[model samples]
Target: MKKIFLVYSFLFSVFIFGQEKSGAKQFWENLQKQCGKSFEGTVTEGATNDTFRDKKLVMHVRNCDEKTIRIPFFVGDDKSRTWVLAYDNDRIQLKHDHRHEDGSEDKVTQYGGTTTNAGSATLQFFPADEETCDLIPNAAANVWWITLDETSFTYNLRRIGSDRLFTVKFDLTKTVGTPAAPWGWKD
Candidate 1:
Protein backbone atom coordinates (compact mmCIF):
# COMPACT_ATOMS: atom_id res chain seq x y z
CA MET A 1 0.00 0.00 0.00
CA LYS A 2 2.86 2.40 0.78
CA LYS A 3 4.54 1.65 -2.53
CA ILE A 4 1.34 2.36 -4.40
CA PHE A 5 0.97 5.69 -2.65
CA LEU A 6 4.51 6.74 -3.49
CA VAL A 7 4.11 5.80 -7.14
CA TYR A 8 0.92 7.79 -7.40
CA SER A 9 2.55 10.80 -5.78
CA PHE A 10 5.46 10.74 -8.24
CA LEU A 11 3.15 10.51 -11.20
CA PHE A 12 1.06 13.38 -9.86
CA SER A 13 4.08 15.62 -9.60
CA VAL A 14 5.16 14.80 -13.12
CA PHE A 15 1.72 15.55 -14.47
CA ILE A 16 1.57 18.87 -12.72
CA PHE A 17 5.08 20.06 -13.50
CA GLY A 18 5.62 18.55 -16.94
CA GLN A 19 3.48 21.16 -18.58
CA GLU A 20 4.13 24.55 -20.26
CA LYS A 21 2.38 27.84 -19.82
CA SER A 22 -0.86 28.26 -21.79
CA GLY A 23 0.27 31.40 -23.59
CA ALA A 24 3.66 29.91 -24.44
CA LYS A 25 2.09 26.98 -26.21
CA GLN A 26 1.79 28.75 -29.54
CA PHE A 27 5.33 30.11 -29.39
CA TRP A 28 6.73 26.69 -28.73
CA GLU A 29 4.67 25.23 -31.52
CA ASN A 30 5.92 27.85 -33.94
CA LEU A 31 9.55 27.26 -33.03
CA GLN A 32 9.12 23.52 -33.39
CA LYS A 33 8.41 24.08 -37.05
CA GLN A 34 12.08 24.95 -37.58
CA CYS A 35 13.37 21.73 -36.09
CA GLY A 36 15.62 19.63 -38.32
CA LYS A 37 16.42 22.72 -40.38
CA SER A 38 19.20 25.27 -40.67
CA PHE A 39 19.21 28.91 -41.54
CA GLU A 40 21.87 31.42 -42.59
CA GLY A 41 21.87 34.87 -41.13
CA THR A 42 23.92 38.03 -40.87
CA VAL A 43 24.90 40.29 -38.05
CA THR A 44 22.27 42.87 -38.74
CA GLU A 45 23.22 45.10 -35.84
CA GLY A 46 26.19 45.47 -33.56
CA ALA A 47 29.12 47.67 -32.66
CA THR A 48 31.63 48.81 -35.24
CA ASN A 49 34.21 46.41 -33.84
CA ASP A 50 31.87 43.41 -33.77
CA THR A 51 33.76 40.21 -34.54
CA PHE A 52 30.79 38.70 -36.33
CA ARG A 53 30.92 41.33 -39.01
CA ASP A 54 31.40 39.79 -42.48
CA LYS A 55 31.46 36.30 -41.03
CA LYS A 56 29.31 33.36 -42.03
CA LEU A 57 26.49 32.92 -39.53
CA VAL A 58 24.51 29.72 -39.30
CA MET A 59 21.91 28.38 -36.90
CA HIS A 60 20.73 24.81 -36.80
CA VAL A 61 17.57 23.72 -35.08
CA ARG A 62 19.24 20.46 -34.37
CA ASN A 63 17.63 18.62 -31.46
CA CYS A 64 14.34 19.11 -29.76
CA ASP A 65 11.99 17.31 -27.37
CA GLU A 66 8.83 18.19 -25.56
CA LYS A 67 10.59 20.19 -22.86
CA THR A 68 13.76 21.51 -24.47
CA ILE A 69 15.14 22.67 -27.80
CA ARG A 70 18.79 23.16 -28.73
CA ILE A 71 19.85 25.45 -31.53
CA PRO A 72 23.53 25.67 -32.33
CA PHE A 73 24.84 28.95 -33.67
CA PHE A 74 27.94 28.93 -35.78
CA VAL A 75 30.09 31.90 -36.68
CA GLY A 76 32.49 31.14 -39.51
CA ASP A 77 34.39 28.03 -38.38
CA ASP A 78 33.64 28.60 -34.72
CA LYS A 79 31.02 26.24 -33.39
CA SER A 80 31.20 27.01 -29.70
CA ARG A 81 27.79 28.56 -29.18
CA THR A 82 24.38 27.02 -28.68
CA TRP A 83 21.07 28.37 -27.47
CA VAL A 84 18.94 26.17 -25.24
CA LEU A 85 15.27 26.83 -24.76
CA ALA A 86 13.52 25.13 -21.86
CA TYR A 87 9.74 25.14 -21.71
CA ASP A 88 7.68 24.95 -18.57
CA ASN A 89 4.16 25.42 -17.29
CA ASP A 90 4.84 28.76 -15.63
CA ARG A 91 7.63 30.15 -17.83
CA ILE A 92 10.39 29.33 -20.30
CA GLN A 93 14.15 29.57 -19.97
CA LEU A 94 16.77 30.59 -22.51
CA LYS A 95 20.33 29.49 -21.83
CA HIS A 96 23.59 29.88 -23.71
CA ASP A 97 25.84 26.84 -23.95
CA HIS A 98 29.39 27.81 -24.80
CA ARG A 99 32.13 25.29 -25.39
CA HIS A 100 35.70 24.99 -26.55
CA GLU A 101 37.33 22.99 -29.35
CA ASP A 102 37.95 20.03 -26.98
CA GLY A 103 34.27 19.95 -26.00
CA SER A 104 34.87 21.60 -22.65
CA GLU A 105 32.48 24.07 -21.13
CA ASP A 106 33.47 27.73 -21.10
CA LYS A 107 33.54 29.94 -18.04
CA VAL A 108 30.58 32.00 -19.25
CA THR A 109 28.42 29.10 -20.29
CA GLN A 110 24.81 28.42 -19.28
CA TYR A 111 24.02 32.09 -18.84
CA GLY A 112 20.49 33.16 -19.63
CA GLY A 113 17.12 33.99 -18.18
CA THR A 114 13.50 32.95 -17.91
CA THR A 115 10.50 34.68 -19.38
CA THR A 116 9.03 37.21 -16.97
CA ASN A 117 5.57 37.05 -18.55
CA ALA A 118 3.50 35.05 -20.97
CA GLY A 119 5.01 36.52 -24.10
CA SER A 120 3.34 36.61 -27.46
CA ALA A 121 3.54 33.76 -29.91
CA THR A 122 5.66 35.76 -32.34
CA LEU A 123 7.99 37.28 -29.75
CA GLN A 124 9.42 36.68 -26.28
CA PHE A 125 11.75 38.48 -23.87
CA PHE A 126 14.11 37.16 -21.22
CA PRO A 127 15.82 39.36 -18.68
CA ALA A 128 19.09 38.32 -17.12
CA ASP A 129 18.42 36.16 -14.09
CA GLU A 130 20.29 36.01 -10.81
CA GLU A 131 22.66 33.36 -12.07
CA THR A 132 23.58 35.45 -15.08
CA CYS A 133 24.20 38.53 -12.96
CA ASP A 134 26.52 36.60 -10.69
CA LEU A 135 28.32 35.06 -13.64
CA ILE A 136 28.68 38.40 -15.44
CA PRO A 137 28.11 41.39 -13.23
CA ASN A 138 27.86 43.94 -16.04
CA ALA A 139 25.10 41.85 -17.60
CA ALA A 140 22.76 42.42 -14.70
CA ALA A 141 20.59 44.71 -16.77
CA ASN A 142 20.78 42.73 -19.98
CA VAL A 143 17.66 41.62 -21.77
CA TRP A 144 17.59 39.10 -24.57
CA TRP A 145 14.73 38.74 -26.98
CA ILE A 146 13.82 36.52 -29.90
CA THR A 147 11.29 37.33 -32.58
CA LEU A 148 9.89 34.64 -34.84
CA ASP A 149 7.56 35.25 -37.73
CA GLU A 150 6.59 33.71 -41.03
CA THR A 151 9.58 35.13 -42.87
CA SER A 152 12.31 35.69 -40.33
CA PHE A 153 13.74 34.84 -36.93
CA THR A 154 15.78 37.45 -35.13
CA TYR A 155 17.83 37.03 -31.97
CA ASN A 156 18.64 40.24 -30.16
CA LEU A 157 20.32 41.44 -26.98
CA ARG A 158 20.33 44.80 -25.27
CA ARG A 159 21.84 46.26 -22.12
CA ILE A 160 19.05 48.15 -20.39
CA GLY A 161 21.22 51.06 -19.37
CA SER A 162 23.90 51.04 -22.04
CA ASP A 163 24.38 51.15 -25.80
CA ARG A 164 25.40 47.51 -26.09
CA LEU A 165 23.22 45.80 -28.65
CA PHE A 166 23.58 42.78 -30.91
CA THR A 167 21.12 41.45 -33.43
CA VAL A 168 21.12 38.56 -35.85
CA LYS A 169 18.37 38.00 -38.33
CA PHE A 170 17.98 34.63 -40.02
CA ASP A 171 16.00 34.29 -43.20
CA LEU A 172 13.25 31.75 -42.71
CA THR A 173 11.97 31.95 -46.25
CA LYS A 174 14.70 29.47 -47.20
CA THR A 175 16.63 26.63 -45.62
CA VAL A 176 20.34 25.97 -45.56
CA GLY A 177 22.57 22.92 -45.20
CA THR A 178 23.28 21.81 -41.66
CA PRO A 179 26.82 22.11 -40.39
CA ALA A 180 28.75 19.69 -38.18
CA ALA A 181 27.56 19.14 -34.62
CA PRO A 182 28.59 21.98 -32.34
CA TRP A 183 31.20 21.55 -29.63
CA GLY A 184 30.05 19.68 -26.53
CA TRP A 185 27.09 18.21 -28.35
CA LYS A 186 26.88 14.68 -26.99
CA ASP A 187 25.64 12.24 -29.58
Candidate 2:
Protein backbone atom coordinates (compact mmCIF):
# COMPACT_ATOMS: atom_id res chain seq x y z
CA MET A 1 0.00 0.00 0.00
CA LYS A 2 2.88 2.35 0.73
CA LYS A 3 4.42 1.71 -2.68
CA ILE A 4 1.09 2.45 -4.34
CA PHE A 5 0.77 5.69 -2.41
CA LEU A 6 4.26 6.78 -3.46
CA VAL A 7 3.44 6.13 -7.12
CA TYR A 8 0.30 8.24 -6.87
CA SER A 9 2.28 11.07 -5.30
CA PHE A 10 4.82 11.05 -8.13
CA LEU A 11 2.09 11.18 -10.72
CA PHE A 12 0.44 14.07 -8.96
CA SER A 13 3.71 15.98 -8.88
CA VAL A 14 4.16 15.57 -12.62
CA PHE A 15 0.67 16.80 -13.27
CA ILE A 16 1.21 19.87 -11.16
CA PHE A 17 4.53 20.64 -12.81
CA GLY A 18 3.03 20.37 -16.27
CA GLN A 19 0.20 22.65 -15.32
CA GLU A 20 2.59 25.29 -13.99
CA LYS A 21 4.66 25.27 -17.11
CA SER A 22 1.62 25.67 -19.30
CA GLY A 23 0.28 28.40 -17.08
CA ALA A 24 3.31 30.56 -17.68
CA LYS A 25 3.08 29.99 -21.40
CA GLN A 26 -0.55 31.00 -21.31
CA PHE A 27 0.21 34.23 -19.50
CA TRP A 28 2.68 35.29 -22.17
CA GLU A 29 0.30 34.22 -24.88
CA ASN A 30 -2.41 36.42 -23.45
CA LEU A 31 -0.07 39.38 -23.44
CA GLN A 32 0.73 38.78 -27.08
CA LYS A 33 -2.93 38.61 -27.86
CA GLN A 34 -3.00 42.32 -26.96
CA CYS A 35 -1.30 43.08 -30.21
CA GLY A 36 -2.87 44.09 -33.58
CA LYS A 37 -4.69 46.85 -31.74
CA SER A 38 -4.42 50.58 -32.36
CA PHE A 39 -4.52 53.06 -29.52
CA GLU A 40 -5.20 56.74 -30.19
CA GLY A 41 -3.98 59.16 -27.55
CA THR A 42 -1.75 62.11 -26.82
CA VAL A 43 1.89 62.06 -25.84
CA THR A 44 1.75 64.33 -22.85
CA GLU A 45 4.67 66.54 -22.03
CA GLY A 46 7.46 64.64 -20.32
CA ALA A 47 9.78 65.88 -17.63
CA THR A 48 11.92 67.66 -20.20
CA ASN A 49 12.90 71.27 -20.06
CA ASP A 50 12.82 71.16 -23.82
CA THR A 51 10.04 72.81 -25.79
CA PHE A 52 8.46 69.56 -26.96
CA ARG A 53 4.88 70.21 -25.99
CA ASP A 54 1.95 67.92 -25.44
CA LYS A 55 0.36 66.76 -28.68
CA LYS A 56 -1.82 64.04 -30.11
CA LEU A 57 -0.06 60.80 -30.91
CA VAL A 58 -1.04 57.41 -32.22
CA MET A 59 0.45 54.11 -31.14
CA HIS A 60 0.02 50.81 -32.82
CA VAL A 61 1.19 47.52 -31.31
CA ARG A 62 0.92 44.51 -33.55
CA ASN A 63 2.41 41.24 -34.71
CA CYS A 64 2.93 40.25 -31.10
CA ASP A 65 4.35 36.91 -30.06
CA GLU A 66 6.53 35.38 -27.37
CA LYS A 67 9.56 36.56 -29.33
CA THR A 68 8.74 39.95 -30.82
CA ILE A 69 6.25 42.77 -31.42
CA ARG A 70 6.00 45.63 -33.87
CA ILE A 71 5.34 49.05 -32.33
CA PRO A 72 4.74 51.97 -34.62
CA PHE A 73 4.24 55.43 -33.16
CA PHE A 74 3.63 58.84 -34.65
CA VAL A 75 2.65 62.33 -33.50
CA GLY A 76 0.89 64.72 -35.84
CA ASP A 77 2.37 65.21 -39.29
CA ASP A 78 5.67 63.58 -38.40
CA LYS A 79 6.48 60.51 -40.43
CA SER A 80 5.56 57.25 -38.75
CA ARG A 81 8.33 55.03 -37.47
CA THR A 82 8.17 51.37 -36.63
CA TRP A 83 10.00 49.74 -33.76
CA VAL A 84 10.62 46.06 -33.55
CA LEU A 85 10.42 45.02 -29.91
CA ALA A 86 11.60 41.58 -28.90
CA TYR A 87 11.48 39.69 -25.62
CA ASP A 88 14.94 38.25 -25.09
CA ASN A 89 14.41 35.86 -22.24
CA ASP A 90 13.82 38.39 -19.44
CA ARG A 91 14.44 41.61 -21.33
CA ILE A 92 12.32 43.62 -23.74
CA GLN A 93 14.67 44.82 -26.45
CA LEU A 94 14.64 47.14 -29.47
CA LYS A 95 17.15 47.47 -32.26
CA HIS A 96 16.42 50.51 -34.35
CA ASP A 97 16.61 50.25 -38.09
CA HIS A 98 16.01 53.93 -38.79
CA ARG A 99 14.10 53.49 -41.96
CA HIS A 100 13.07 56.47 -43.98
CA GLU A 101 9.63 57.00 -45.47
CA ASP A 102 10.97 55.19 -48.52
CA GLY A 103 11.45 52.01 -46.45
CA SER A 104 15.24 52.40 -46.25
CA GLU A 105 16.88 52.33 -42.85
CA ASP A 106 18.57 55.64 -42.01
CA LYS A 107 20.24 54.54 -38.79
CA VAL A 108 20.07 51.87 -36.12
CA THR A 109 19.92 51.99 -32.32
CA GLN A 110 20.43 49.33 -29.69
CA TYR A 111 18.36 49.43 -26.51
CA GLY A 112 16.35 47.15 -24.27
CA GLY A 113 14.60 46.96 -20.88
CA THR A 114 14.12 44.46 -18.12
CA THR A 115 10.70 43.55 -16.79
CA THR A 116 9.99 44.05 -13.10
CA ASN A 117 7.90 41.89 -10.82
CA ALA A 118 6.20 45.02 -9.48
CA GLY A 119 3.98 45.46 -12.54
CA SER A 120 6.11 48.17 -14.18
CA ALA A 121 8.10 48.14 -17.43
CA THR A 122 11.35 50.05 -17.92
CA LEU A 123 13.60 50.65 -20.90
CA GLN A 124 17.11 51.98 -20.51
CA PHE A 125 18.23 54.96 -22.54
CA PHE A 126 21.39 54.75 -24.53
CA PRO A 127 23.57 57.62 -25.87
CA ALA A 128 23.31 59.04 -22.39
CA ASP A 129 22.82 62.71 -21.70
CA GLU A 130 25.23 64.77 -19.63
CA GLU A 131 22.74 66.32 -17.20
CA THR A 132 20.29 65.19 -14.55
CA CYS A 133 20.63 61.57 -15.52
CA ASP A 134 21.24 58.79 -13.03
CA LEU A 135 24.35 56.62 -13.11
CA ILE A 136 22.52 53.38 -12.36
CA PRO A 137 23.74 52.30 -15.86
CA ASN A 138 20.03 51.51 -16.14
CA ALA A 139 17.49 54.22 -15.47
CA ALA A 140 14.09 52.73 -14.82
CA ALA A 141 10.82 54.45 -15.71
CA ASN A 142 7.23 53.38 -15.32
CA VAL A 143 5.94 51.98 -18.60
CA TRP A 144 2.26 51.98 -17.78
CA TRP A 145 0.79 52.68 -14.36
CA ILE A 146 -2.74 54.10 -14.62
CA THR A 147 -5.40 52.01 -16.23
CA LEU A 148 -9.12 51.52 -15.89
CA ASP A 149 -8.92 47.84 -16.71
CA GLU A 150 -6.46 45.05 -17.45
CA THR A 151 -6.58 45.70 -21.21
CA SER A 152 -5.34 49.26 -20.87
CA PHE A 153 -2.09 50.79 -19.61
CA THR A 154 -1.13 54.43 -19.05
CA TYR A 155 2.41 55.71 -18.68
CA ASN A 156 3.60 58.99 -17.31
CA LEU A 157 7.15 59.73 -18.41
CA ARG A 158 9.47 61.09 -15.76
CA ARG A 159 13.08 61.57 -16.67
CA ILE A 160 15.66 60.64 -14.09
CA GLY A 161 16.68 63.56 -11.91
CA SER A 162 14.27 65.81 -13.75
CA ASP A 163 11.05 67.50 -12.64
CA ARG A 164 9.17 66.96 -15.89
CA LEU A 165 6.56 64.28 -16.44
CA PHE A 166 4.67 63.35 -19.60
CA THR A 167 1.51 61.32 -19.81
CA VAL A 168 0.86 58.64 -22.40
CA LYS A 169 -1.76 55.92 -22.37
CA PHE A 170 -2.57 52.90 -24.53
CA ASP A 171 -5.92 51.26 -25.11
CA LEU A 172 -5.80 47.61 -26.12
CA THR A 173 -9.37 47.33 -27.26
CA LYS A 174 -8.80 48.60 -30.84
CA THR A 175 -6.69 45.61 -31.78
CA VAL A 176 -7.37 44.43 -35.26
CA GLY A 177 -5.26 43.18 -38.11
CA THR A 178 -2.80 45.70 -39.59
CA PRO A 179 -4.81 48.65 -40.83
CA ALA A 180 -4.15 50.46 -44.11
CA ALA A 181 -2.80 53.71 -42.69
CA PRO A 182 0.90 54.19 -42.19
CA TRP A 183 0.66 54.68 -38.42
CA GLY A 184 -2.01 52.02 -37.96
CA TRP A 185 -4.79 54.45 -38.82
CA LYS A 186 -8.10 53.19 -40.05
CA ASP A 187 -9.27 53.23 -43.67
Candidate 3:
Protein backbone atom coordinates (compact mmCIF):
# COMPACT_ATOMS: atom_id res chain seq x y z
CA MET A 1 0.00 0.00 0.00
CA LYS A 2 2.83 2.43 0.83
CA LYS A 3 4.59 1.72 -2.48
CA ILE A 4 1.42 2.29 -4.48
CA PHE A 5 0.70 5.53 -2.65
CA LEU A 6 4.19 6.87 -3.33
CA VAL A 7 3.97 6.08 -7.02
CA TYR A 8 0.64 7.81 -7.34
CA SER A 9 1.91 10.89 -5.53
CA PHE A 10 4.96 11.14 -7.76
CA LEU A 11 2.88 10.86 -10.89
CA PHE A 12 0.50 13.50 -9.65
CA SER A 13 3.34 15.91 -8.94
CA VAL A 14 4.79 15.36 -12.41
CA PHE A 15 1.43 15.99 -14.01
CA ILE A 16 0.97 19.25 -12.13
CA PHE A 17 4.40 20.68 -12.81
CA GLY A 18 4.62 19.26 -16.29
CA GLN A 19 1.44 21.00 -17.23
CA GLU A 20 2.92 24.33 -16.23
CA LYS A 21 6.08 23.78 -18.21
CA SER A 22 4.13 22.48 -21.18
CA GLY A 23 2.00 25.57 -21.25
CA ALA A 24 5.04 27.70 -21.99
CA LYS A 25 6.65 25.09 -24.17
CA GLN A 26 3.55 24.79 -26.28
CA PHE A 27 3.44 28.51 -26.83
CA TRP A 28 7.03 28.50 -27.96
CA GLU A 29 6.39 25.66 -30.35
CA ASN A 30 3.39 27.40 -31.80
CA LEU A 31 5.52 30.44 -32.56
CA GLN A 32 8.28 28.32 -33.96
CA LYS A 33 5.85 27.13 -36.57
CA GLN A 34 6.18 30.51 -38.20
CA CYS A 35 9.91 30.28 -38.67
CA GLY A 36 11.19 31.83 -41.90
CA LYS A 37 7.72 33.17 -42.62
CA SER A 38 6.56 36.74 -43.05
CA PHE A 39 3.24 38.37 -42.46
CA GLU A 40 1.74 41.81 -42.98
CA GLY A 41 0.06 43.58 -40.10
CA THR A 42 -2.15 46.56 -39.43
CA VAL A 43 -2.42 48.83 -36.46
CA THR A 44 -5.88 47.97 -35.31
CA GLU A 45 -5.87 50.26 -32.27
CA GLY A 46 -4.12 53.25 -30.69
CA ALA A 47 -2.63 54.58 -33.89
CA THR A 48 -3.15 58.13 -32.77
CA ASN A 49 -0.20 59.41 -34.78
CA ASP A 50 1.03 59.26 -38.33
CA THR A 51 3.85 56.86 -37.49
CA PHE A 52 1.81 53.87 -38.58
CA ARG A 53 -0.70 55.48 -40.87
CA ASP A 54 -0.73 54.46 -44.53
CA LYS A 55 2.40 52.40 -44.16
CA LYS A 56 3.22 48.88 -45.14
CA LEU A 57 3.83 47.01 -41.92
CA VAL A 58 5.53 43.64 -42.01
CA MET A 59 6.96 41.21 -39.47
CA HIS A 60 9.27 38.38 -40.35
CA VAL A 61 10.15 35.42 -38.24
CA ARG A 62 13.65 35.70 -39.50
CA ASN A 63 15.47 33.40 -37.12
CA CYS A 64 14.36 30.67 -34.79
CA ASP A 65 15.93 28.17 -32.45
CA GLU A 66 15.05 26.23 -29.38
CA LYS A 67 15.88 29.09 -27.07
CA THR A 68 15.43 32.26 -29.08
CA ILE A 69 13.42 33.70 -31.94
CA ARG A 70 14.22 36.95 -33.73
CA ILE A 71 11.47 38.73 -35.64
CA PRO A 72 12.19 41.81 -37.67
CA PHE A 73 9.46 44.40 -38.06
CA PHE A 74 9.48 46.57 -41.13
CA VAL A 75 7.54 49.75 -41.66
CA GLY A 76 7.55 50.76 -45.30
CA ASP A 77 11.29 50.69 -46.06
CA ASP A 78 12.50 51.18 -42.49
CA LYS A 79 14.19 48.14 -41.04
CA SER A 80 15.28 49.35 -37.65
CA ARG A 81 13.24 47.18 -35.34
CA THR A 82 13.24 43.58 -34.22
CA TRP A 83 11.39 41.73 -31.53
CA VAL A 84 13.32 39.02 -29.75
CA LEU A 85 11.77 36.31 -27.66
CA ALA A 86 13.91 34.14 -25.46
CA TYR A 87 13.09 31.28 -23.14
CA ASP A 88 15.25 30.90 -20.08
CA ASN A 89 14.99 30.16 -16.39
CA ASP A 90 11.51 28.80 -17.06
CA ARG A 91 10.32 32.18 -18.26
CA ILE A 92 9.69 33.83 -21.62
CA GLN A 93 11.40 37.18 -22.15
CA LEU A 94 10.54 39.83 -24.72
CA LYS A 95 13.09 42.40 -25.86
CA HIS A 96 13.12 45.05 -28.51
CA ASP A 97 16.32 45.34 -30.51
CA HIS A 98 16.56 48.56 -32.46
CA ARG A 99 19.23 49.49 -34.97
CA HIS A 100 20.10 52.12 -37.50
CA GLU A 101 20.80 51.69 -41.19
CA ASP A 102 24.50 51.60 -40.43
CA GLY A 103 23.93 48.48 -38.32
CA SER A 104 24.57 50.37 -35.13
CA GLU A 105 22.56 49.74 -32.03
CA ASP A 106 20.09 52.41 -31.11
CA LYS A 107 20.30 54.40 -27.88
CA VAL A 108 17.00 52.84 -26.80
CA THR A 109 17.40 49.13 -27.37
CA GLN A 110 17.23 45.86 -25.50
CA TYR A 111 14.53 47.02 -23.14
CA GLY A 112 11.85 44.55 -22.06
CA GLY A 113 10.88 42.11 -19.34
CA THR A 114 10.16 38.53 -18.46
CA THR A 115 6.90 36.75 -17.95
CA THR A 116 5.67 37.12 -14.39
CA ASN A 117 3.05 34.42 -14.42
CA ALA A 118 2.25 31.11 -16.05
CA GLY A 119 0.34 32.61 -18.90
CA SER A 120 -1.81 30.45 -21.12
CA ALA A 121 -0.43 28.37 -23.95
CA THR A 122 -1.53 31.00 -26.48
CA LEU A 123 -0.75 34.20 -24.59
CA GLN A 124 2.02 35.78 -22.52
CA PHE A 125 2.50 39.11 -20.77
CA PHE A 126 5.74 41.03 -20.23
CA PRO A 127 5.73 44.02 -17.95
CA ALA A 128 8.41 46.64 -18.23
CA ASP A 129 11.57 45.80 -16.37
CA GLU A 130 14.21 47.93 -14.66
CA GLU A 131 16.11 48.36 -17.90
CA THR A 132 13.10 49.89 -19.61
CA CYS A 133 12.68 52.29 -16.71
CA ASP A 134 16.30 53.37 -17.07
CA LEU A 135 16.16 53.67 -20.85
CA ILE A 136 12.77 55.32 -21.20
CA PRO A 137 11.52 56.74 -17.97
CA ASN A 138 8.16 57.64 -19.40
CA ALA A 139 7.64 54.02 -20.45
CA ALA A 140 8.37 52.60 -17.04
CA ALA A 141 4.84 51.35 -16.64
CA ASN A 142 4.60 49.52 -19.95
CA VAL A 143 3.09 46.11 -20.27
CA TRP A 144 3.61 44.23 -23.52
CA TRP A 145 1.76 41.15 -24.51
CA ILE A 146 1.54 38.83 -27.51
CA THR A 147 -1.32 36.53 -28.24
CA LEU A 148 -1.32 33.70 -30.75
CA ASP A 149 -4.37 31.82 -31.86
CA GLU A 150 -5.22 29.62 -34.78
CA THR A 151 -5.83 32.52 -37.14
CA SER A 152 -3.96 35.53 -35.86
CA PHE A 153 -1.10 36.91 -33.77
CA THR A 154 -1.43 40.20 -31.95
CA TYR A 155 1.24 42.37 -30.40
CA ASN A 156 0.03 44.91 -27.88
CA LEU A 157 1.48 47.47 -25.49
CA ARG A 158 -0.04 49.69 -22.84
CA ARG A 159 1.39 52.08 -20.27
CA ILE A 160 -0.16 51.47 -16.91
CA GLY A 161 -0.22 55.09 -15.80
CA SER A 162 -1.08 56.76 -19.08
CA ASP A 163 -3.25 56.48 -22.16
CA ARG A 164 -0.47 55.10 -24.27
CA LEU A 165 -1.50 52.01 -26.15
CA PHE A 166 -0.33 50.26 -29.34
CA THR A 167 -1.68 47.16 -30.97
CA VAL A 168 -0.93 45.42 -34.25
CA LYS A 169 -2.45 42.25 -35.54
CA PHE A 170 -1.16 39.84 -38.19
CA ASP A 171 -3.07 37.26 -40.09
CA LEU A 172 -1.53 33.85 -39.66
CA THR A 173 -3.52 32.08 -42.32
CA LYS A 174 -1.61 33.86 -45.08
CA THR A 175 2.12 34.37 -45.41
CA VAL A 176 4.11 36.55 -47.77
CA GLY A 177 7.66 36.20 -49.03
CA THR A 178 10.33 36.98 -46.47
CA PRO A 179 11.67 40.49 -46.69
CA ALA A 180 15.30 41.56 -46.72
CA ALA A 181 17.26 41.46 -43.49
CA PRO A 182 16.73 44.20 -40.96
CA TRP A 183 19.20 47.08 -40.92
CA GLY A 184 21.53 45.45 -38.44
CA TRP A 185 21.30 41.87 -39.57
CA LYS A 186 23.44 40.26 -42.23
CA ASP A 187 22.02 38.09 -44.99
Give the top-scoring candidate (TM-score): 3
Which residue segments of model 3 deviate by more than 4 Å?
Answer: 2-21
Which digits, one per residue and each the tens of the lDDT, describe model 2 over residues 1-187?
9999999999998898754423223334555655667676645555455333445466666567668777666555554456555555544444332445655544333222333332222222222222212323333432322322355645444545656456666666554344344533333
Candidate 1 displacement at residue 44 in angstroms? 1.4
TM-score of each: 0.87, 0.56, 0.91
Q: What is the lDDT of residue 143 in candidate 2?
A: 30
Residue 16, candidate 2: alpha-carbon lDDT:
80
* Candidate closer to the true structure by lDDT (higher is better), 1 or 3: 1
What TM-score would candidate 1 get against the native? 0.87
lDDT per residue, candidate 3, 1-187, as tens digits? 9999999999999898755555667788889999999999999888577588578999999999989999999999999999999987667999999999999999999999899875778999999999999999988899999999888889999999787888999998999888999998899
Candidate models: Cα lDDT each: 0.92, 0.48, 0.90
Clashing pairs in 3: none
RMSD values for the candidates in order, in angstroms, are 7.8, 6.5, 2.2
Ranking by lDDT: 1, 3, 2
Model 2 misplacement above 4 A: 1-27, 44-55, 94-97, 116-149, 155-157, 174-187
lDDT of 1 by residue, 51-115 (tens): 99879999999998999999999999999999999998747799999999899999999999999
